[model samples]
Target: MTTVERTQVFLLPDLGEGLSEAEIVEWRVAVGDIVTVDQTVVEVETAKAVVDVPCPYAGRVVALHGAAGEIRPVGQPLITIAPLDGDGGAGDEPAGHATYREEERAGSGNVLIGYGTGHGGSGRRRRRPRLAVAGEPPAAVGTGAVAQTDPTGPADAAPAGTGVTASPGSSPALVISPIVRRLAKERGVDLASVRGTGLGGVIRRADVEAALADAAAPAARLAAVPDAPEAHVGLAPAGDGDVVIPLTGIRKAIADKLSRSRREIPEVTIWVDVDATALLETRAAINAATPDAPVSILALLARICLSGLRKYPQLNAHVDTEGQRIVQSAGVHLGIAAQTDRGLLVPVLRDAQRLTTRELAAELAATTAAARAGTLPPARLTGGTFTLNNYGVFGVDGSTPIINHPEAALLGVGRIVDKPWVVDGQLAVRKVTQLSLTFDHRVCDGGVAGGFLRHVADCVEQPALLVANV
Candidate 1:
């Protein structure tokens, strides 16, 4: 007697916000384990945020489509879940393995924008049928093959070249996902590069990704591209005497953004020295009176930035060079430059215009703390109309900061220290700091840019100008 069971493949849902791909940080379930609808099955990290992907179907976990740490694009199969029973189980077992049957492509009645589901609910659903060759054994179905059971694993222990070996006589690596194949093919990777890391030597998406990364490494790409410039740009292959660090993950993201900013934006910086004596005293007085929650220098600077933006709204905007447009924002989404263990991350405070000094301080503290802990969501890292960078924490006096792309301007504040100033026609020591503004010339001219910086300086010099408003 032949018994048939049906399974459903859950594609990774659009985690919202136009993100295309996410890395599989971890999986919460295993094969043969029961799961219910809306269960958190996996944690994925996109370019902007780390999100928990939920299982939309209730069934037994038949297979995990990708391994942990593998990057999967949108609409890719994340997991395969099968219905519990055709007749509630408790029946005679089949000989070796039940013939895997095909299922329709109707998603769990759940999907994100632009991929499978669309308007009118009539979007053509694409079915993915992962099947075993006719007469082929299905023992490898949903098999969670352990990584090379070596006496030689990828583990720290064990000598190299002593791990599990796939003899040429064995069947080609049991691959179930088309994504894995497509990835390898796109990168011109040989599927036989090594044994698959999946069940029964079934290759996982991670294996293919690793192959693609290895092929794209600087050492490997030397023969593919002209090497003269890259060598000067630190792209040369490492020698025995050299320790080469590859740009990857967050570092790679930073490199790409900085390069694009430097290449596309024609930037110019203007600086002014401000006597911060009054501002310092005002902040101290406020803190001394409150003692509960103190306003930060960043918060004060942010308040002044918003005020300055109000007078010169053009600086708080984005430049759409492709459209030949200067887009001015109605409100400020203030990005505070934060240096964290992960790297330099700019977390935006949405609609910062309406926030009071205390509230701004709280938000800045929270945002910076979250960034340091690497817990800030990806969405919070983007969409800024202006940026306030306090380089004083780094013990620097000023910087010609690169403008955060799309945004037209960045305000940099330097360390406030005792500096000689002419007061009442006499040389006096005063608390002074440097303020610099880097802007895209397309947005505004020097007259407007200078005015904005002058307004900030005026507020910093006469704290009452800003403190009263706060």
Candidate 2:
């Protein structure tokens, strides 16, 4: 008979995003799997994004408290581990020392920074651990580093708690969305004066618009100048006085998505010009009929593209890497490249082709609202058959949008501008918009992608052609 000692580990406070709960996306280590401290053990999805949680103590994984996709609360036992002893077999420890001494604990002390790694287990506790709380994964930290200590406390160990540290200041700096930051940078508006109405009092796109609107308020009551101070940090370079902007949260997400797309997918782009007179007129008519409906150019473009997707099934396809096959979708789930304050977010409209023009407009409005609010569910932002980016809204002529990886293609719609064209052998003014379609050339050849774009432009140019097909 063999005797062994087991210990339970509790979930820490700031898993990330200051969230109290998190959904377990995956368990990297299962029961009985040997795991070292600081190794990634599980992946969790919070409200904002997916993150990986690391092991707190170095030991053998004895148990997992929850299954994948299960919501767990913070300060609960996530996993139990069997600590290694002198008699512990000659198992494996990487080419490094594995020491277990009382060190500083997580979520203790002066202030809480964003979710990074925390301190360690206190005084060799052999108590039961709790489940993980609902929250984002702790922010990524450097390898094998412990949270710094609090000299004021006794040289023991920090006790188990939520592990989420709170901000020290009364009015901690306002949190601004990616879209708000972009608009502010472009328009030279101060974000400090803008009152945030978002979750956790975060600054939002609407807040920036409100601040811009109040720019003419009485000088005495005016809000303090925004972002200018940060911008003017240097007139002339001083002893390496560089500004350190932290990249975490939404900015981190944007970097990951773009990097993944470029690294994993082979992309090719094709461009064409489409007559937009009918599309514009059609939108105007729809708006007049339902004054309350927020019918915009996006709705018309989405409908046209959805129709084209049904006609060209190959364009509405996804690469199945494991299956080693191309999966042509039977239905169209269109992702609109929505530019928000916190960067680019693509909210999908499921079975888009099945919906009417008004429904498309309504879904677009709802999805965009959810995205900008940072309340969009992870599922709504995932699994798209195709994507559409309206560079036209920004008054841009044309652009080659990167293909959303896994999906075969993305369509970029340019701004509609008046141009002279031959009509009845005579030059006439016509509304024209350029369309740039970038696809994964590996999945679809240039001939097929080109034909698809040409067909889509034809539908937009003569929307009546769609009526004929229907």
Candidate 3:
């Protein structure tokens, strides 16, 4: 019997929630390394969060598809593996060369939520062939290098007068990813005029962004000059000690999301200064009673926010811009805004309304720690119906924070400090804190917003109100 070896191509799986692409952060497995089923092969950073992608096959890694810092579209080839047989030789039938029929039998039975290798089939869409290999340098333009053809082929190639050059038998400009194309179209950037620095002269998201910046350079320079005409002015060259950082990854995601929120939502901010002395006392009493499961002020505030939402369910919802309707949530998936080294990440606590104060504290502590460590899965970072921002840790008194996109509201808590308060007509020192609610005006009028803020203030001023409401 003769043995045949065929390499299996593992295409990138569809990361859930309609995410189309991810940037390769790091590769855990190298070519020629043995990998077991469900072993993490690479770490990828999506627009929303960082995720570790696992390989479903057990084999020897033959090739890695993309290099670190490269953007790979979902359904593109990610890795290749060759199955190992007895005596460390290749298998009788290489799984990679197997037909669709053989693929049914060779399925690894592992799934990554939206994608998997099962009896049904590998849910991979065939993409355009890319000539670039991992660790290979990108092709330089105008250097007589033949441009690679994308899926569109020569029919959609850049024209001869568009400043893009092409050698015989190659397209003028290559755009392998649909994401890159959409970005260029949205930004009104002419693809032919923009130089591609990606593998095989392919244009990338960064290329589109750079083209936009270049287009705006003249206007930026004009604004810097005093009473300058609308003429092209050169920007001063960078001096020594000037460092330029490209906005990418999490920082880019944050910028896009916040920009969208600012653009789309009609927001309003209302604040109140409340005496938090009672809230502090209540926490002390709870801790004294249950030291093992002590509660935090944030947890107490979270519980209060849930209570407030119960009364004003409109605040616990998001707007459907296309549908032009306000969609309220049936349950509270509270998002705790935690500032991590990576950036600001909000980890959702599902069914938070049902959790006790102690449980909320423990879960919040664990999730916040995981977020800071950058070990949180992508699923935990999304689907937030409402966000709670505790900027008090930053020593700020109050902030009118932007509402988290899609979500209708955000409750911001400030640091609690001592202040003079009149109790029974006598001035006395009391713990004071400022509470601000930044909400989408589309969800509710000022009356409802004010009522919700007042309810929270009442709870903070007199913790007994929470007991009475309960």
Candidate 4:
């Protein structure tokens, strides 16, 4: 018998609560395809972004564990690979061999976002920070009730502490994962009766059924409760009003992310009113020089930001728990926060320092087109070192932007509204724009953040600062 090496291909783990199970969008390689470590093999779409899952082990794909369109839970098997035998088929599974390796570190396990161990057949969701829900009683500290559901079932519903609101004198809706909610909604289960065993009495589907079984009563047989109004009320039907669509998709994501950021991250926001008149002229000149090039202020700002990042690399960092470790990176992958119909997608421009202004504009144009057309690849959404959000395009003066997670700061560029400014003690109407810088106070204090913003402001104010290419 020809002995062949066998490896178990585990399911891709959730990047975070932002994703639960990703749809297997595409499979780059098939059974019998020889793949090396770090080679892109599959594409998966999570709630936040599409990602390419690289091959963990260098071997021949012997079998596919999951099919395309299958939403495999995190820590489940997605594909299987083995050494080709003389006849066929990968040899028997090696004793105590669990093949999984993370991208951050290659080892005996699969890669996952943030931090954790390799996949070792221990299928359990990693514990995350317990966010306080809005208007809800704190977790079972004094409730004097045993939770009927698992707390960690689905933890992404409430943004940090913006907990769900309950009707006056009514019990708060049990917090549950999206999957559980879907199942309960489908089965018409009474979510209120289901006590959660998960952290803080968050409900799970199993908890609902278990609660039902424990009560020895059918969900349908339970006492009826009055129906609540829809979450989002449409435009007032009684009043003469234009169509008012409820917020959804990109708008919703932005709202949730920003709300969570404001409520959670201690933000130190500073503002600088810059005379971007010269910068505007420079951009017009550049764009006029190359008509085909996309030369919006955002593209220019991106390049300017990249240049300034070299001077203050600490601004392009992420603060892990305890506000201790700030992961300051060398490369500048600027995430252009693009609002798409699907949601707010931050497709990254990897290694922005290498690209020229014109090239950056072209790339942004292409990437933005792709995002608008829904053709952006998975790679485009990953590896963002820092982020830039241009509210200017939408014609806003300025507003503090929430920093994208894992990044230390975010720059919000507002509309270049013509405003009167004191130039050398003289009031003058100039093409003015405001730069709102929101920084993670844990990693960087106000002084350092102020310097970064001032530097950028200087670049925008005195276009010479940018022309000098510093």
Candidate 5:
């Protein structure tokens, strides 16, 4: 019996939560390897979390579209697979076309965005909208092709160089990725002048970088001339020995978020030093009673925070700038700020108010560990109502950290150390720690913020206050 096989292209699925792109961290499979349906093929890092992307089709891998560390937009081809027949022979139909038909019939499973198995709902996949350039016609549908038009007449097209193929026409330069456009804009490079070497004449990030490098020499020469304008003087180029690192992945995400917070939120910080001796003693006593389940200082502080939020619900809310309202959360989703090698990650414990002290401790410890290991899903990394930052673990006295964006407040704990304290009019050594609350001024004034911090301090100073309140 004759057998035939056709190649199927797997586009990168929507990694969830409206994420547009992901950086490829590692590829688990290579060309010529047979991958089963739902088999993990590549690991990608989005702005929110690291994810293991599974292949929806079972077949022999024909191609891997991206290298590790490359950022691929969603809906871009990720992997190409050739499905094998029962006799292990190739299919009669063309490699690419037959796969699309098969995809329509069998569906690409529930993992991808556009196509899904017919368990429920429509099986048709949605396509990403194409970015239209000047003089370009509306993009053709259902075909993975970009419409390119040269601004200069085709007869006057310039010779291709450095990945740029300039042609004479009335259309603007063909650029795809927004990252490329942003880079060009920031560097003052004219996109209309730079040609695209990417598929279908799309200008890519590399092309913009090349343009920037080519312009650097002439700009420097012009600046070196005597009596020359000092406009670009302060912009020092990197030295040969200097290691210039590009901000990408988690670092870029952090920069964008913190920048947005600074730009939008009107934040205020207030701090107080608390005697944590009683809190420590209470933890030790509880741990001694339940040796199997030891509660951490962070968990105790988290419990204190939950109580404070209950009293001052204003701080437990975020500002909806679009609606011009303070949107308070119904439940406490506690975000624990954890520093990881990848960057700063905040893994949240959902409905934290519902958990007991021991349960909070377990979840906090596990979530933090998973965050540092880069194993937590994207869902676990977002939707936090408030953030808890234990900067004390770094042995620091205090910090005024930026509030995690959208969240109304962040509680920062400094290092706990022995300090002189007055007990019953006598001075004695006690465990002292600084607690700082940075809150959004738009949510509440200093009155509410101070009340919340003071309540937290009261709990730390006298554990009985928390017990009584509970």
Candidate 6:
């Protein structure tokens, strides 16, 4: 008796915080593998972080949507799963259900990183499922070139488990979807006989259905034709001194962010040299007095930033060009630019203005630790109104740092070193550092920017000024 088997696709999900696409880092399960709900089927690397995506449906994997290293967009099929077959319900008895339809109707109730099999849930609204070929995977769709397509159907289409490698000077068979291949195989039809209408001659489900109707005809029109000119990459010899490295993962994210910041923001930079001798001495005194609970230079600087922001709130605000308004946030959601082992990361601190120096130091330590460990959640990486970049840690004397986008200004602190200074007409050495403030001109003019930088420099030169302000 002929019966219909149902197939469903598990799509690539929005991981968190509105990520669009992710690279297939590794596949935990393979085709023909049986998987239970909540099983991690694949590990993918989003632009900012790596995440393990769990399967929300329990079924047998019929096909993998893409191979490793391919970047797949959300809502695209990640895997095709065939539910247990049933006279009415295939694995009903084991599933504690009456039929396959019942099991599918019940659904996996749990929501994962924006993915769930449930029809009704509080999670993100599920996307409408697009129908695809019952057997063909997205990768098998087309090679994007006519040269890679087989105009003639050959048994060369690799079956499951046998590595399908096209012979030299011959392109790989375009048949990838098992459904399409199975239909042709069962009907005793040659795939090469069918003329492909898919992109660059990739066969589709409609092609298979059309082939079945004209059984009495000579051959299916969608089949690949005779051997065509092969497309192969010309590679340089092993000793080619320079190697090309692809920008991906965190690196790609940084590149995109920086490029966008430069393109959109009309940035201007203003810098000043400050005598940090008082700041250093102040830190030493506080450390010596506190002994165990010593304060950090960053903590003092953070205090000064909050104080300066109160005086000049414009620099602490963001320009919403689209809205044609400046968003002046009351609480400083401060972002600290930290260079971690993974890459440059800016972890945000919510309501940083309310924290004390000691408290700010602790929060900074925790955020930096989380950033370096790559355990900082997506929430910790966004929503900052201002940024404090300590480029001095890199041992640089000065730098014109790019302003973090959305935020109007970024404060950059340079390496503090002993330098020649005129102290009351006497030439002497004093600890000094260069401070730079890169700001969006649309948000504020040079006067506002200069006022903010000078205020920070004043606090550095005279710590007593911050104490009085506090």
- In angstroms, give how far residue 306 of model 4 lies from its true place: 1.8
lDDT of 4 by residue, 192-295 (tens): 55567776677765785675455443333212224733221222222222323445433455577767767767877899888889898988887788787657
Question: Cα lDDT of all candidates, in order?
Answer: 0.67, 0.62, 0.71, 0.62, 0.73, 0.68
RMSD of each: 11.2, 14.3, 11.9, 15.6, 12.4, 14.4
Candidate 5, 334-381: lDDT as tens digits = 999999977999899999999999999999989999998888888888
User: Per-prediction count of colliding residue pairs?
Assistant: 2, 28, 0, 20, 13, 26
Q: lDDT score of model 5?
A: 0.73
Model 2 Cα shift for residue 444 (angstroms): 1.6
Candidate 1 lDDT, 242-299, residue by residue in tens = 2234454466677778889889888899999999999988899999999899999888
Candidate 3 C-alpha lDDT tens digits along 296-356 = 9999999999999999999999999899888999999999999976689889999899898
Query: How high is each candidate's TM-score?
Result: 0.68, 0.55, 0.70, 0.53, 0.71, 0.65
Error of 4 at 392 (Å): 1.6
Identify the leading candidate in terms of lDDT.
Answer: 5
Candidate order, lDDT descending: 5, 3, 6, 1, 4, 2
- Candidate 5 segments whose C-alpha is farther than 4 A from its true place: 1-5, 91-108, 112-240
Q: Tell me the deviation in Å of residue 445 in model 5.
A: 1.1
Better of 1 and 6 by TM-score: 1
Q: Poorest 10 consecutive residues of model 2 by lDDT?
A: 157-166
Clashes of 3: 0
Once model 6 is optimally superposed onto the true structure by TM-score, how far is the C-alpha of residue 466 displaced, in angstroms?
Answer: 1.9
lDDT score for candidate 3 against the true structure: 0.71
lDDT of 6: 0.68
